[model samples]
Target chain A: MVYTSERHSHRGSRGRGSRGRRRRHPEPPRERTGGDIARGIVRGFGELLFTAGLLMLFFAAYEVYGKQFETDREQDQLAQGLEDQWEQQEVRGPDSEPLPGSANSRLYIPDLDLQWVVVNGVSQEDIRYSPGHYGDDAVSGGDATAAGQPGNYAVAGHRTPGIFWDLDLLENGDQIVVEDAENFYTYEVIEERTVTPDQVEVVDPDPFNAENNEDPQRSLLTLTTCAPRLNNTHRLIIHAELTDTRPKDEGMPENIADMAPETQAAAGE
Target chain B: MYGLIWRVLPGPWPVKLLLTLVLVAAVAAGLWFYVFPAIDPYMPFNDGAVEVEGG
Candidate 1:
């Protein structure tokens, strides 16, 4: 640690006398071994695993939150398309049928505080936009007339948050209303059942087959969704009988009074 | 780890800063285009089966 008296030592003048004035401490080395290399590899691998776990966390967050944005965007587009159709077309009556995949109606569940614009087909792509009308013979076709029809008017939706996520929470006697632009068809839940995914018979005209369609006495609403979120092991079915039908000109039904304002507004009251 | 990288780089301040920015942008692009998309299907949400009613 000797101090040099040469003022040129701090300058850029590199002569033999100035070389040793500010020399750094020499590092001890020459300890390379196979074990050290192996330890370094293992440490790097551990860091890689930690980074992988963080990536998985980000991916999970994206799957849960990111997909919601996509669904919401699709729903907004579908809703706008439906509004355009409603404005451009004539008022549909008891005899007219909405085209497949066309936006046809809305469903309001007061107990669950859920409202979704109903699309017309049950295909995966269709339900991705919104709850879809089941177009099997067991259920009525996707027509405006199907609202108050004397047979099963079945609908299917996903169990995700924006869709029928709380459907399994519906209890007997709960009100499920299906509405088009012109009419509101109210259905009171009579039964709830969880069946295997193959149980298409749940959507039959007479789910219990208590009577044939010759009489076609009851107007029914059958709502279905995949049961047990995160897995598709079974189907959750909610069966409701039509309780009332009111025209849009008459305003929203009384049951919709406690619903969100947007819901009430969507009802066009 | 990042400090080790900063110490190891040999350049002027501005050049080092530019290199750091480029590295960050490349990692972000890799995550956005490859890593995230590859792991999406394995996530637990929205994995419903794609089958018609009758089946």
Candidate 2:
């Protein structure tokens, strides 16, 4: 009787051990405490927010710096194209009309070490690769030119980089040299002002009066960009007047003589 | 979510690692191509013009 009972007990223990080792029925989910559930939900939300925040940071960095790479590359191509166009046998005269959306001139700001090939037209497509001239027939009612008739040669660009970013650093009387195929026009900053984004009147040739559409009495240069650096709510405008104009064949202007080597290298000399 | 995926996957370490890499690549591509672009307009990346009536 002792031997039989011992064997039976051993068999029962073996069954219990197997049951513990491998549960036959799936376990019911544990009853989570209210506090535990709340914590889990908060953690999940926090994780989601963290991921979104990281993505936003990456995007901001790309917009600020990465976009510059593309703009620089486009500038190089545009510069090359402009150089090639000038080298061709078909030379344009001083009175030739400037076409919208076409690269027409080079703007050099020695004070800020800024230079860019200016394209005509202020359309988004036109300004994507370079600073765009505010065309006369623009729906915005502003006008710009490089070597055409004497008028406001207003241009718009982004304030981030590779454009008019350091425009604010320029004070009154700074020289802004502009050159096209045939002539160099030097302008001096006369005024600086900040206006709301909607103040399209600032770009008008007669900024004081929108109704005054008479011929421009003097040549003007207007540089416009988003102000306060990252904010686009306001526009920073620098108004300048043509101080000197000389034919390009007369050679590089005295003001930009120091930059000749750099300019030449940039033009792929 | 990632931990749950790891538990559900049935494979040895090497196969699981490879699958994880591919899964990561797909997620990144989806975010880059679709998710980010959808959120772009809401962000202030563009320096687009603002219209102003004469004042």
Candidate 3:
């Protein structure tokens, strides 16, 4: 039955007797019928849709996987530059302004096994490859202070893989360590919440309380990223307060060293 | 569509195979470096920072 059906299809197009003869000389161009034209148009449209679907799949793959490699390289370079700056003891003074897009500090979320060199400004360009600190001008009528300062040290990063992809896993009481050239400021997570993109108050000195204009008595850290992983309709904010500050010469803080065995050994603990 | 291209190629089977590989690489490179980066800014994955209007 299969052979017969195959023969039927071949005979419908061109019979076996003429197949051999047609190979020597090309057939004359046949006039296209209305049905033939319609079929051609439908097939062309189908092919176009198939190509478009393939392109979209490729783009999604690049966004999820390919982009991670780029971020990894950029992070490595930034970390190296930061280390060199630290080695030279060129750390910026607390009163001196930081250069935009420059790597200023190292951020370590020991629970997440993540570390990134934080940049100076929170602009898109500044945070493209690394988490960026919110500068004083980030929000109108609001002041963003430096790390370990008695104000909000707000930082923002992309939700892509290798960055803040696992930010949602952070819970209250988690330890987040921010290291400047001179000291490591350990922050204890106080709250984790989601807010709308317009809620810039989350980065204010006193989050969610705009009326309180007085100086913040405690040094706080705010990490903002997109919520629900791949979506950006909301922002995920993690608020933490500085719990401990130790000189870099003293080695990694107890909380951070406890999380990593290699670091613990390196610290000679 | 690919079968059509294979039949229309002028060279022998090996040459056609090489040409197909080259064509695939070219398309992949174009998509990776140019098309993807060009459309990345419009994507929602990187819009993580909160911004107030006029702020």
Highest DockQ model number: 3
Ranking by DockQ: 3, 2, 1
| Docking class of predicted structure 1 | incorrect
| Model 1 residue A134 CA deviation in Å | 0.8
Determine the iRMS, in angstroms, of model 1: 4.4
Best candidate (score: lDDT):
3
Q: Give lDDT per model, in order.
A: 0.68, 0.70, 0.78
Q: For candidate 3, give the lDDT of residue A226.
A: 86
lDDT of 1 by residue, A1-269 (tens): 23342433433243334353345214221243344477678887887898789777766665566656656767666666666566544655434555677787778898887777788777655776588877643242222126678877888887766777778888999998887767888899999988887676666666667455444567888888878775678878889999898988888888976764776444343
Clashing pairs in 3: none
Give residue B8's lDDT in candidate 1 (0 to 100).
77
lDDT, model 1:
0.68
Please report how far candidate 3 places residue A76 from its true position, in Å: 1.1
Worst 10 residues of 3 chain B by lDDT: B46-55
* Residue B25 lDDT (model 3): 91
| TM-scores of the models, in the order given | 0.71, 0.73, 0.81
lDDT of 3 by residue, A203-224 (tens): 8887756565366777889999
DockQ, 0 to 1 scale, candidate 1: 0.19
Which number leads on TM-score? 3
Off by over 4 Å in 3: A1-30, A84-93, A140-142, A208-212, A258-269, B1-4, B52-55
